[model samples]
Target: MTSKYMALPKGMSESSFDAAIEKFKKALGAENVMIKDEQVRPYTKVMMAVPTEEHTPSAVITATTVEQVQAVVKICNEHKVPVWTISTGRNFGYGSAAPGRRGQVVLDLRKMNKIIHVDPELCTALVEPGVTYQMLYDYLEENKIPLMLSFSAPSAIAGPLGNTMDRGVGYTPYGEHFMMQCGMEVVMANGDVLRTGMGGVKGDKAWQVFKWGYGPTLDGMFTQANYGICTKMGFWLMPKPPVFKPLEIQFDEDSDISDIVEFIRPLRISQVIPNSVVIAGVLWEASTCNTRRADYTTEPGHTPDAILKQIQKDKHLGAWNVYAALYGTKEQVDVNFKIVQDALKQLGKGRLITEEMAGDTQPFKYRAQLMSGVPNLQEFGLYNWRGGGGSMWFAPVTQARGSECDKQKSLAKKILNKHGLDYVGEFIVGWRDMHHVIDVLYDRSSEEETKRANACFAELLDEFEKEGYAVYRVNTAFQERVAQSYGKVKRDVERKIKRALDPNGILAPGKSGIDI
Candidate 1:
């Protein structure tokens, strides 16, 4: 169909690339096949501090059906062409919708946004890849259904399918997205459909209720890997409780972080604090209210300490901010709130802000909204902090201990400040683990700044790995480097699985750095 193939796939000539895409177009349609340079620009937007050219997609194939996806994968396998997949293409701060490798076609599943089923009695919903959190939330509201949705910070546009596939976290009891999922429908690289959990059996009414089938479960293999393209997934939704209490514990001193995690661990593990506790540094909370660094200073580099302190003072925030909520009956909330208040009071410094105290402001307002299943775009303000449109989330997982949190905070802060960048990060306390997430935000427009950001990121990986701290998730730009931090034996096993599942390497060649 196209007389030209300007951006051919790797090792492909104009004629060959055109022929492959023509076959893809036939499976869907010429209108759905995006090959023009201008047509694929939307898929090239990368928020990471790297050159945008490397992330540009050669073409984009918008598949509206599972059968169409199977046909497209077959075409890619036959032509030895790499393929990248994006659910809604709204995965900001990671890579957006860009393909992992250049010249690979993006299989956009946004058009297949179908809320196939929502069983209120079972609190389960089967959704296609294109079904976004906002879409699902609106459906519940329009139908006047009494259910809550646990979603990431950027909940308005990000989809549950993509977030769960990437193992993204949220702020509710159902915070672990993947664990909340009970089923998945994936389109394999060889053009075959496989259903995990109870979906494997035909006419199985318990497909959405039972997570594991009769044999060895196969759902974990598809997550955060290049193994398959998930077309549909079933996620468990939270039933609305009678009482909801959002709590905030703001500490004044840096030394207080040494006790924050330790104090919260028991409460979190015991289920007294059911939701994931969000421990945010002052800068993270500040960005939600303050738009740019120049609002406090005119310096082209990192904001001065004095200015940051002034921002904290002026904004009425603390050195660190902790947000979590108590949900259940009214009597249950009162008892848990008193326990949380008494334990957190041991620090003898923080000011506990109740829901009544916080009005229409952030980070309290936004955190409260997310905990209640209300979707908002408040987290997008992080990109506006430096004003250069660059951000990379450096997330490292550690044990839920005070010493570990202190060590990670100290090391990360020193490294970040040494690189002339500020530490805009937070810690989401899971049941047994703490995810220390750092946003390496920088000015992409400045070549010098981008260079520093890249070096800072590389050093972080190197130094953290030496300390036995490994990032749980990373953007596409540093997947290769981050992959090595886990060691070779693990990498070898991943590569073996990739080779076995996708021999042609046609599906996301360098995703999480798993390739032949």
Candidate 2:
């Protein structure tokens, strides 16, 4: 049975691959290495439209310490086996626990769960790869620390190190995860540990407080790249505010999306809205209330606008829901609240909902939880909306202009409706940009639907590129295609760097299409 599912690395015979596995088992302990069919099955599970066999791993090596990671890298280099590294393996819509290509080893770093240090005065923390948001939150709460945490919606299970390295965002003022990162300890391809930023200095006191070192900064290179495996990281923490006010604005018309963005852009740019604001669509907000597609219609195609309007009415949801929060002293929040309320009233189409009005209501409750720096898994309800456990996040960066957002929404909806799928999307507003995130939900159980989903995703990539819009991140199935959109010169330069750092191509070879 094990032999039936065995997938050896390219250019490696069965016997040679067996020898490499033995070395891996000896380096990390026999129990830490997994090569059985059942043990390796979970590593190959992917939610993308592609086949799972395409991302199968030859084996899984769990590392508990930085030294063990170095040992695994050395063995892979010697055997010419490619290795794909994952921090907690909970990257959900983005290739969770899977390799970039077939037959590469999976370097699972989840066993390295340790919170190295947390300074209450400096509001800084040094943590291992597996220190999850919930874990850190519990630590701060237990110790009576006054620091707050900002994390992605799946904050209960997701870790900061992986999300920060992947450049994910949260709903708090410090939503840009990577921008808050100060330093990191990475395990290089050559089995050496390189510390970034102020960490390189002996007896460094400000490693987690200072971001820049004396020379060139290398922290940005490791993100979204396969240059090194980050073992430990340091980042800043936001201090708890004197008062927190989470609010929502509901717009009745789908056409009001442009006007809504136009109004919010100035507020965000001027720092009047201190948190990362979320403008979610009707379907996206409805999904949070446990509403399923089967409830409204059993039809195979996209749900009609009539039924969508009905759902919005039944759930008391707007065509678009805007969520943002204000933090600071009581006086500061009072002044900002008045400004927000007056502006929305002047806009005429929006109905403002404060914490008092939205008490314990779903969707709003979860959104409020996130903006207030609490951990919750309420957003996971999105998986049940389509009901086949298929989700792909098609995220594109756009200017914070009203016209640009309207154009993107129209194009995305047209393409999705053409493929018999619903458009469950949102716009996460930044100071000068918007992360337009659209979850391409489908039923993977049906062969026909799976094929259609694959085609739909491809068409989205092609059409968006022609319009000069590109996705910020994609799953393993489309990484190579998305990398081409950047141009040949950038691709060539990335390859040169990959070769210089990892000559044997032992790291993730197909990652961003940059391999030696």
Candidate 3:
């Protein structure tokens, strides 16, 4: 079951590989390199489909310092071998720690994890590639600091650098994590170094805010591309808000989603609701929380209609759930809550709930805790959803016209259903547009399920492209489909950029499906 695409170079000899292994071991201590069959095998296969039964790596080099990373890259460049950079190897669906092209040595960076600096005055933090959200959260809370951390939904174990590099979104005001990043230190394709923003200037602190040069914005070039190894990066931190309130609005019918969308658009753009607004369908919440037994039935004869009926009977089918956070003064939150309630009532849909629903438990307070950006979900054990294998696709759409949003949702659901896959569509309302993240979950163990999932994803891409919608984040498994959405012209332009930045195509070669 080894990947045919991942074999050693066609004519590579034992002596050549042995020589490379010796050089790697000499550069990095023997303990830092893992070349055993069991160790290197898992690093070879990705988590998209079930990993191949056997995986053999030319070598696995663990770099403890940036200098070692440079040495590893230098060696790979000299030998024309590929190098794959992995931090924690938790990138489930997008080929975790596995190189897209075969024969590449895995560059594990978990050892480089370090919170080098936390500048409260400048409101920025410098971290290595291996720092996890959980680690950052613990540091912030243990110190009882006033700064806020914006983290993705499953903030328990995912690395901050990998999430930002992939453009992961969170539920706080600074949900766009990548946009919050200011500067980075990248090891280019030929073992050279490049710094973004003011990082190029010696002894400059402007990297905490300024994000542009006299010419182009190079930071974006590193994201979702085969550009270079991002060794160190700095991201902006949210100042602790005076008050945080998490609110939810519930609905009971499918047609009411459009009404809810229309009601929130103005509030989002007006800065009244500056954070990311998520409108999750009831089914999505049920599936994610495992509260709806109807959907997770183990019986072979289960039907969607039966599941829908059960959900309705339990009154758990809250046609939709809207989640938002209000920051500022306590008075401002109270005012905003009232405005939101009143607006929903005007549309004949005001049945709402806050932490008040749990009475003494205080769900609002818990929502505030989440808004604080601390990683607390591990205690609940919900982090084990995928059995350690799953993928996420982020699709962004504008809400200028509610009808168009509805149409897209309908088309997406129909396609997913056609393939017998479960999908949850969440609406992330930005200032002027909406990012409808369609979270698709499937079992990687079944080959039939894997093929069906791929087909459904491909169909959705074709339909969305024809309708003028763009996918914000795509799994490495479907990179080609995602690049095609940008059209031939943009693809060519991206190719030219890749060639200019990475002439050897050594860094993240198969990522984003961009070729030189």
* lDDT tens per residue, model 3, 126-185: 899889888887787788767888876656778778889888777788888998998989
Clashing pairs in 2: none
TM-score winner: 2
Which stretches of candidate 2 lie above 4 Å from their native place? 1-5
Worst 10 residues of 3 by lDDT: 378-387
Q: Which rank order by lDDT, best down to worst?
A: 2, 1, 3
The number of clashing residue pairs in each candidate reads 0, 0, 3
Tell me the TM-score of each prediction against the true structure: 0.98, 0.99, 0.90
RMSD to native, candidate 3: 3.3
Which regions of candidate 1 deviate over 4 angstroms? 1-6
Per-residue lDDT over 1-516 for candidate 2, one digit per residue giving the tens place of the 0 to 100 score: 346335878778878888888999899999998988999998988889988889999898899999999999899988898999998888888889999899999988888989999999999999999889999999999999999999999889899999998899999999999999999999999999999999999998988988888799999999999999999999999999999999899999888889999889888987879989999999999987789999989988999999999999999999999999999999999998888878777777799898999899899899988998899998888888998878888998899888999999999999999999999999999989999999999998877888888899999999999999999888889999999999999999999999999999998898877778
Alpha-carbon error at 319 in model 2, in Å?
0.5
TM value for model 1: 0.98
Evaluation by lDDT, superior candidate among 1 and 3: 1
CA lDDT for candidate 3? 0.71
